[model samples]
Every structure is written in structure tokens, then in C-alpha cells.
Target: MTFFTPKKLPKAPLLVVIITLMGAFAPMSIDLYLPAFLQIQEGLATTDSEVKKTLTLFLVGLCIGMMFYGPLSDKYGRRNIILIGATIYSLTSIASTFIANIEGLQALRLIQAIGAGACMVVGRAVIRDVFKGKQVAVMMSVVQVIMMIAPLLAPLVGVMLLYVFDSWRALFWALTFFGSMAFFLTFFFLPETYKKEERPKITIGDTFYNYFLILKDRRSLGAMLGCALPSGITFAYVTGSSYLYQAKYGLTEFEFSILFGLNIVGVIVSALLNIVCLRRFNVLTLIIFGLCWMSISGIVMLLIGGQSLIGFFLSTFLLMCVSGFIGNNIVSQIIELNYDRAGAAMALNSSTQFFVGAIASLLVTHHQELLVPVMGISGILAVIAYAGLYQPWREVRASIEK
Candidate 1:
């Protein structure tokens, strides 16, 4: 009997759009509740620090969840695990609306994030299953562009929900709707991309072993760090941007919002440029250029040091654009290198990003003074990661010796 293949799956553009939405669960869940943090604190009689833990808990959950879902998807198939994740996500989001205390809400958010992890892990795996080489980079850029919409619109949506309902619980209701939509989309439209013949015999031991092998490989570690360290810089900005833009730079909320939105737009443009440039250059070259540019941008921002708002903004914008270039290319390389264990590779890659982000967030929250320096240092570390760990020169030398 002829078995199904991704070649017969939905058209590439449509598939890209669908999986991109699946991958957006994290940003949507995080951003949707940000505007309602004060409301949640008041409603639950909690402290600001406790409300902050919810974000930390969510990231923690993402790390734990992706670790399992990656190997699970490799064994079971992408569609099945995504369906399970969507179900948990939707039900937990609904349950969150009924939660009364801060502790209860935190627990529910953690569970909901675990469910979101399935979407993220499997979504990238699906892309790797169907696309090859530079095609992966191009599609990844498209995914980044589309996934950015969640963060761009979520805070506005959160504010609107708060205005309409006058309660922080309304934010959970919105998430419920989003989760439900993801469920229906996955159940109906998403095809099984991980072919049965390709699946490994994954048990608990097998899962850990897969992770061990990936993490132990120098190139994999390097590529994973290449993607993750820059993410730490982005999260640092996310954690500290309000303080930097409003209190330090003396910008109004209106002006800060405009600048924030413009930064995201800059990222989108950069991703689009990556797509165009993929036709002329390989993923590795672009990734190297991106890291170098990010380092320079961060250094420039540090030199500006809030001396000029325009200089700071331009430098920051350039630094953020690296997100569009480095992440997709590095991820594409990781998945390519670990094609036999794409799920495990993505799990390690994505979990490391959350872990790094959590650390960065803490650093910025405590010492807002370190934000620019952290950004500059993260870019420098990313370059070191790519050069020291990835070590493309070894391959060049071997090829010449041959």
C-alpha cells in the first residue's frame, strides 16, 4: 500500500500560514494578559512580584513541555500531539477564567503553556519535514513575519477586552477563544507530516537519550546557542523597555507605544529581506552577517547610552532586526542537522531560548542599568557561539584536505 507523504499535503503557502499560527501561541498568551496585570493583582489581592511569577512560570512550563512534546511528536506523529496540546490549551484557558486566587491562576497558566509547547515544537518539525535547504530558511522567515502579528496586536486586544468587560478574567476568555480556534484549525486542516515509517521507537529512555545526543554534539550546541543568546537580548528589552523608554528617555506612553510598534515593524521588514536575500545567499552567510550586525548595533546603542533618543532608537532597531535573521537560519540549520530527530532538536533549541530569556528577564528586572550592556554582550556571545561551537572552518579545512 502507498503511504501518505507531505508532498501530497496542502499547498506550501497555506501550510506555512497554518503552522505559523500554531507557533504563535506563546506570544499571544503572554502579550494578551500583560495589560491586565494590574487588574489581576487587584482582583486576586496579590503583590506585583506574584503577578510577575506568572510570566516566569509560563516560561518554565514552556521549557518543560517542549522537552517532552518533541520526542513524543517524533514517535507518535505531529498531528496527534498537536491535537492533544490544543485540547489541553483550550480547556485550561477556560478553567483560568474561573480561577479566584493568584496561585490558582499561576498553576493554570503553567499548564496552558505546556499545551502551547506542542504547537511550537510540532509546528517547526512540520516545516522541517516538508522543506529542505534554503527553502527552510525562506519559509522560516515567512513564519516569523506572520507569528509577529500576535505580539503586535495582543496588548491592544487585551486593553480592549479590559474596557469591554471591566475584568482581568476577560483576558483568559480571550485566550480560551484563541485556544479553541487553534484546536479547530489543527483538527480540521493540519495533516500528519511525520510519516509513520520514519518514526523511532520512543519511550522515556529514548527521549532522554535523544536529548543527550543532541546536547552533546558541539555543532548542535553551538547552533542552539546561536539562536538562543540573541533571544535573551530580546527578552531583556521586553522586560525593561517600559523603564528605558518612559522613565529614562522621558517619553510619553503614546510615544513609547509608537516606538515599540515600529521596532516590530522593523523586524518584519528584516524577515522579508531575509526571504528576498535567500535567493542570492546561503543561510550560514546571512546568519554570520546578522550576528555581526547585531553586535555592532548593540555597541552603538551602548555608546549612545541614552544621549540621543533618535540614536538610541535607531541602534535598538538595528539590534532587534537580528531577531529576524539569526533565529530562523540557525533553527533551520539545527533541524537540518538533526533531521532524524528534528523534534528533539527543536525542543532543545526552544527550551534553551526560554531558559536564557528567563535569566535575562531577571537580570533586567533587577538591574535596569544593565539593559544596554546585556544587549551588547548577548550579541557578542552569539558570535562566539557560532564561531567557537559551530566552527564552519573545520568543514572548510576537511573539504580542502579531501
Candidate 2:
């Protein structure tokens, strides 16, 4: 039997929105607390680095949770897994608001991450189950557009919560509410996409072997690495930006949020460009162009230092835009490479990206002053990714054409 393509989908718009909402949960969990990082540290009497550990723990939970959700979704169904995950996420987020110490908060954040991870992996798997080829590309673009709105609004929402409530916990409460809404929406609207007959009847050993197979595939591995390296760069920025903007630049949390919101403009433009370009250019071309943009942005950022806000903003904007291009295309390409076990493939992809992101965040948190080191490392990774992924990807495209 053939995979379900977009032309076969009945309610395309609503389905796209639901899938996008599920994907948005992960970013919302990460970005919403960013503006309050300094405040939380000060209030809880924790070191800046310790506060950053919260983010790291969240990533750890995300990676671990992704691994489990893929197999469970395959066993049960997409809608069931999503509903369970979302409910858990909402409960954990509310629990986070009641935590008094940094450690307690960190623990709850980890649980929240786990729930978000399930949503992300399951959402992608459902999309892959329902779409293929150019339709999948279009659906991926739509999902990105929907997901982008979360990061664009997160900092601003955090800032507003701070202004109104005068406490970081308010942000957690907001997250809890959002999670609750998502949970209900998933239960009510999302239907099961995966059929029992389609699932692999495999044991633990077979699951491991399947994972190994994906890792061994040159094309799949390349696409996953290409996605992960750029994501690491973004995570480095996310982990460092609180300190960089507030402590170094002397901007208030509100001002920093406003600046962060401005950066989303770049993401919006880049995503729009990706949507337009996909009609004409192959995914490999987009990936190549994105890597070039990232390398240029990293080099420019490193060369300029913290000289002017405009320079920093321009560099960061360009970098984020490149991310917009890489994020959707990379996943789209990788998902195409592993159709039979799409859930497992997507879970591994999410796990690796978050694991790499966690490491990048930890590095930046430990070495905040050394901006050059972070940017340089990211640039080097982008170069390797281009050489490893885009080159092979081009050859694959040519062979397909021939």
C-alpha cells in the first residue's frame, strides 16, 4: 500500500494546524522561560550556570522522551501518544510553578520536556504517515510557519508575565495553561494516522537494529547531522543570549525580549523564502544555500564582536533565517529516506538534534565570555555538514534525475 499523500487528505488546513501546534510545544517550553532566567537565578539564590542547567536538563528529558515515544506511538497510535504526552506536559508545567528551589524547578522542567518531546516526535511521524513528496514539503513548510509563531511570541509573553505578575513562576503558569489547551485540542481533533497492519512487529533487538540501520545509511545520517549542527548553533545562542543581552549589553529583560522578537522577523522572511524556493529548487540546493548563510553569519558575528547592537542583530537575524531554511528541509529529506519506520527515524532525529543542542548549550553556559569560541565552533560544524551532507545529497539527486 502507498503512503497517504496530501492530495488524499480531506481536511488539509486543520490537520496541518494540529500537527504544527504539536510541534510548537517544544519551542514554547524552551523559549518561554528565557526572559526570566536572570530573575529566576536571583530569586532562587542560584548561580547563573546552575540556572542554565535547567535548560540542559530539559534537553536531556526531551532526548530520552523522544526515544520512548516513537516506539509507543508505533505500538498504540499517534493520537493516543500525543494526548497522553500533552496531559503529562500540562501537569508538570503546573507543578513547576509551585516549586520553590531551582533544583525542584529543574526536575519539573525535565518532565515538561519529556512531554514536549513526545508531542514533537509523534507530530512529525503523523505528518510523514499522511504525506509524501512535494505535498510533504508543502506541509512541512506550513508546519514551520505555525511553529515559528511560538518563538516569535514566547519572549514577549514572558516579558508580559513578568510585568504583570512580578515573578518568574507566572511564566510557568502560562505554560501550564497553554499545555492544557493543547492537550484538549489533541484529544478532540487529532485522529489516528498509523494503522496496526503498517507497524513493524519487532522485538527490542530488532528496534535497535532498525536504529542502527538508519545511522548507517549515508543519506539519512547526512540529513540528520546537517540538521543537528545548525540546531546546536541556535541552542548555543539561546543558552547564552540571556547573559549576553542582559549582563553584557545592559538591556533589561523587557528590552531583551523586544530585541528577540525582532530576530523572529528574520525567521519569518527566511521561511517564506523557503516556501517559495521549494517550487523551483531541490531540497539539496536549499540545504547548501542555508549552510553558506550560516557560515557567513558566524564569521561576521565573530569578526564584529559586541561592537554595535545593529551588527549583532544583523548577524543573528541572518543566522536564524538560515535555521528556518535548514530545519524543515532537513527533516523532510530525512523522513523521505525512512518511510517504513518513520516513527523510529523521526524519534532518532529529534533525539540527536536535542542531544547536540544540549551539549552546545552546556558549552556556551560554561564559556559565556568567549563568544568567538561558540561562533567559530558552529562555523566549523556548518562547513563539515556541507562537505558531508550537501555533496552526497547532490550526487543522490543527480542519480535520481538520471
Candidate 3:
């Protein structure tokens, strides 16, 4: 845990808007190009494995980059690092548009992800800096609601762009435009949230120590992994959807986008409902509920994801919606920890989730043609998170009773 306290705060609505945009960076970057995978496979002369490498490698870069950016943001400042990171990301997106080879696209996406990772980590830190426990949970749900809209719209956007340009490169160009807008908006509008006077020193040893120490805390690990494991559930659907819908179900690109948007619509509805429910329930209770929903959904998917299209679709929708709840609640628990060390806590919370989620995605991607693995991983991880967090829940209850 850290001792650094926040400085004065900015206006709340504006701050949420900015942070939501930062949060949107990752999903938009990802979902925007998903509809074009088949086209890219043809245009770049790449195999499905190679095309999928772009997704996995981007996640890898995001994981590694966040590990470093968390400590650096704590030492330096959120605004500076975010700007630097977004600039790099925007530049890479632009560069990706011009790359003529699959290897070059893969390399650029990795670097682009490194830059995007800054936004993902620091946005949460900014929230933790200003808001306390319950407020943080509510705000996170609000943020998740706004951010969820990106994926809902992104595939549709990608399809329309593909229709107009008739090329996969159009998606990269769109990313470049968005990235440029983010750079200018952040530069002109965003303020530094972390206080300078109370900042922690930046050192390699201290950073690693802080990271390990957080991991060592059972409660902290519980919260981090609880949020992370569901990510695999979502990513599994994401990585396999084009194949699942197109090859197996015989959906066209336009229809696939509509179906994907329908699932994301579930996420938005859940997030909205979560904002209302947060007023009456504690974070842990909601997390358990979400986990239960995920477990049920996964079991159903395993039993039916391959045989019944409606069953698979409904189960996938449940998994997506539950993800928002689990992540918001888990991160709220992390934010409730030592405020001084909120940056490091958030970093640990984020990087681990990405790392774990990345592995989960990689595993499922390897067997994308199958639904059994997705069901097992998604269902098992939900149960695992619930079991792990139950101890922490008991501890909280004990402390409250005393």
C-alpha cells in the first residue's frame, strides 16, 4: 500500500468523460478492426493464426507496458505519461495503415498497445485518486457503461468503413483519426490528478517491491484476479465470434456486427442496472452475484454453445453483462485499499487482469473452432474467483462485526 494522497480535484462530470474516453481507447482499438479480420487475412496474405497474433501480441504489450507505466505515473504524473503514451499509440495506428506486410502490422499493433496501456492503467488511478470506496464503485459502473458503448458501435462502424473503402486499412486510418483526437483532447483538456507534493519516489526496486507486496496480500490478489478471470470469458467470445458466427452459423459481416452489437447491448443494460443496485448493495455482494451469473451462463454455454445457436447467444450475452459487474466491484475493492499507494494497487489490479486475461484469450484462441474450451475456462474462472473472494468477504464481515 502507498501513502501518497491526491491533490485538489477537477469537475466530476468532465473528469468522468475524459476517463471514459481513456477507457474506450482499448476496446475501440480492438473492436473496431474485428469485423475486418477475414478481409485482412486475404489482403495481407496471412493465415488465421498470424492474423490472430495481432490480438494476442497487442494484449501482451498492454500487459508489459502497464507494469512499467503504473510506477512511472505514480512517480512522474498521470497527465504526462498518458500524453506520451497516447501520442505513441496514435503514431503507431497511423503507421499501421501504411504497413504492407502481416509482420509489420503485428509489430505496429504491439507498439500501439504499449501506448494504449498507459490510458488503461492511469484512468483508474485518476478515479481512485479522487473517489473513495462506494463512490468509486458507482463511478466505475458509470465509466463502464460509457465505455461499453464503444464496442457496441465499433463493429458497426468497422463494417460501414469496410463497405465504403473496401479495404481493411480503412480501419487503421479510423484508429489514427480517433487517436489524434484523443491526443489533442487530452493535451488541451485533461488535468493532472495525482498531487505533486505527496508523490512517491520512482525506483526500480521499490516498484517491484510494491508490486510483489500487493500480490502477496490475499485480499488484493482476490480482487485483482476476480476482475481478471472474467475477461477471458469475454475475450473468448471476441476472438472466436467471426468464426463462430460466420463459419458455423452462416452470418454475413453485417449480420455479425448486428449480433455483436446486440451482445454488447446486454453489457450496457447490466451496467446501467449496476449503477442503480450499487446504492443498496456492497461491492462484494454484487461481485458474487455477477460471478454466479457467469458460472450459470458458462455451464449453459458448455451444454449448448455448439448445438443451439440461441442458447449460445444468450449465454454469451450473460457473460458479457456479468463482466461489467465483476470488474467494477473488484477494482472498487482495490481502490478501497491504501490511498497513498492507489496507483500501484490499480496497476497491480490492471496488469494482472490483462496478463491473466491475455493468457485466457490465447488459450481459447488456440482452440477457437471449439466451444467446449470457452465454456470450461469461463465457467471455471468464475467459480475460482468466487471461491477466492469468499475468504476476503468473510474477513470484511468479521471486521465489520467487531
Candidate 4:
């Protein structure tokens, strides 16, 4: 039961490594089992649609759970919430392996997402707690690079595990091991970022009210849209990729894994570019740049992605590359504006992202044919939302003078 009480916080590089791994829980959960979609359907004796519901419901739970954990972390402390969440996540993952039916597995996944939500909400709060200004964006990009590793490697690992064990249940075992390690990491290494004196006196009612307050603030709401809407494109791709690659494109499991991994490599490239660009460009500029490119990439995708695999691959790669630039910048803005309410602000930001992702999941699942068009539309709408709502040109001009 050792807890870190370092008078000096861990260095930025080390801290980024720790928090990114913790924050990666949600992505790891989704990506790791992706290659086994067919196996899961067979094992549970369920439809592909039912399996997709597991992903959608998990995202819905993440939305609900983030709203709860964010304010509570503001009231209580980050460390305890993380510990409790990791415990829930680990236990649920273990339970998943033994579930006899798809319904039971879906229930476990929903609960697991709730537990995973704590890590995501609180991890961003920790960054806000420790860093400031462009430093926040820089740190976040570093975090994004580390976090992307989960998806970059997860599918490949899942494919290998499938090859060896020939059972999708082995994937849950790996998750069980990961969740347990996360618990130990939090207990021993993670410091309490939300101190007692700074802790807000939050009530049950205050938690729900906080969401309203955030949405009421136009800048906060706009930055949120800038962050969340692009996520719909991401989820649409994630939800449809397995079906697209394997069923339609006729790629083998290992081949699909490699192609999926390449998209992550695109993200890493953009993230590195984002870190370098932060030295000179304003955060708003980087965000606008990313969104604009994303829209262009999506348009290309809509034009030929449906008919040609190469067109889809190249266009999706470009979209993912630019996407790496958006989240860290937009999140840094949301957090700086709402520093006093970092927990709630991040909760709303993340919850909205996941909610949009849930809707995207449903669309991509039901109408796989429309995946390219949906991606295009989501990208275009994201640009409109940011431009109309946030009005970044004013800030861009301000940054130039500074």
C-alpha cells in the first residue's frame, strides 16, 4: 500500500510515460480484440451486430462514467479514484473470460468502460495540475505518441495470441494482466495531483450542474466541438475497419493488423510534427490546420475509397496523420480556460467525444457502405463547428503580436 508523496513531481518525460500508459486503457481495450471479431461472434454464438453493440455500449459507459469520476476527482483526489477504477477494470476483464453468452460479456464491457473512464478523465486533470500553456500541448503530444503505441501494437499482438491460443478468451486474459499492472502502477508510482486545500466541495447535484456550466461557456463548448467532432471520424474508421479490410477487401488477419498499425504510424508522425510546430505556431493555428487537412482527406476518401482499396488506405492515412495534431491542442485550450474545473471540463470533453463515437459506431456498424461518406461529413462538420463557435482567428492574431 505504498503511495508516492514526492515533494518534487516526476520529471515531465517520466510522468508522460506513466500517465499515457494509464490513459491508454480505453484504446487498448478496443484495439486488442479487434482482430478476433469473428472468433468472438462464434464463441458467444451471436451476430456481428451484437458484437458491435459491445463496443457501442462500452463507449456509452465511458461517457457516463467520465461524468461521474471527473467531478469526484475534483472533490476527492485523483489517486484513490484511479485505484478504485483499476480494480473494477481488472476484475471485470477477468470476469469477461468466463462469461458464457454475449449479453454477459456486453454487461462486463460496459462496467469495464466505466472503470476505464476514471483513468482517462483523471489523467488529463493531472496534466492540467502539473503543466501550463504551450507546455501543456507539448506534454499532451508526447502523451499521444506514447498512448498510440497501444493501438499500434495491440492488433498485432491480438493476432499472435489468436494464432497460439486459438481462443478469443486469451485476449481477455491479457487485459486482465494489463489491468492488474495498472493498479500496481497507480498505487506505487502515481502522485496525488489534486491536493486537499485545492479540492472543490462538490456534491451529487454539482456534478451534473458542472456539465451545464461548461456547455454554457461558448469558448469551452466550441473547443469541445473542435476536439470531439473529429473523434467521430476516428470511431467510424475504427468501427468499420475490420469489416472493410477483411470482408470487403479480403485481407488476412495478419495483413489487416499491419495495415491498421500503419495508420497509427501516421498519427505518430503528425504528433511529432505537432510537437515541433508548437515551438512557433499557436495552438489554434495547429488545430485549424489539422481540421482543414482532415476535411480534405475525407473528401478524397468519399470520392474513391468505396471503390478502390488504395484510395481508401492513402486517404485514411492522411486523415489519421492530421488527427494527431488536433486533440492535444484542443484539449490544452479546454483545460486552460477551465483550470479551476479541470476535472469537469475534461469529463465533458471526453464524454462528448465518446458520445459522438458511440453514434459513429452505430452508423458505421449498420451502414458499412456509408463509412467513407460519414467520415467525409464528420470532418467537414468539425471544421464548421470550430470556425463558427470558437472563432480562432482572433486568438491567432493575438498570438502573432505576442
The list of candidate 3 runs beyond 4 A from truth reads 1-10, 399-402
Top candidate on TM-score is 4
Q: What TM-score against the true fold does each predicted structure earn?
A: 0.90, 0.93, 0.94, 0.96
- Candidate 2 lDDT score relative to the true structure: 0.80
For candidate 4, the TM-score is 0.96
Off by over 4 Å in 1: 1-8, 243-256, 305-312, 366-369, 395-402
Best by lDDT: 4
Q: What is the C-alpha lDDT of each candidate?
A: 0.81, 0.80, 0.79, 0.87
Every model's Cα RMSD, please? 3.3, 3.7, 3.5, 1.7
lDDT tens digits, residues 189-239, model 1? 667888888888767679769988998899999999989998777777776
User: Model 2, stretches more than 4 Å misplaced?
Assistant: 1-10, 306-308, 393-401
Residue 224 local lDDT, model 2 = 83
The residue-by-residue lDDT of candidate 3 on 240-313, one tens digit each, is 87778887789899999998999888888888888888888777777778887888787777777767678778
User: Model 2: clashing residue pairs?
Assistant: none
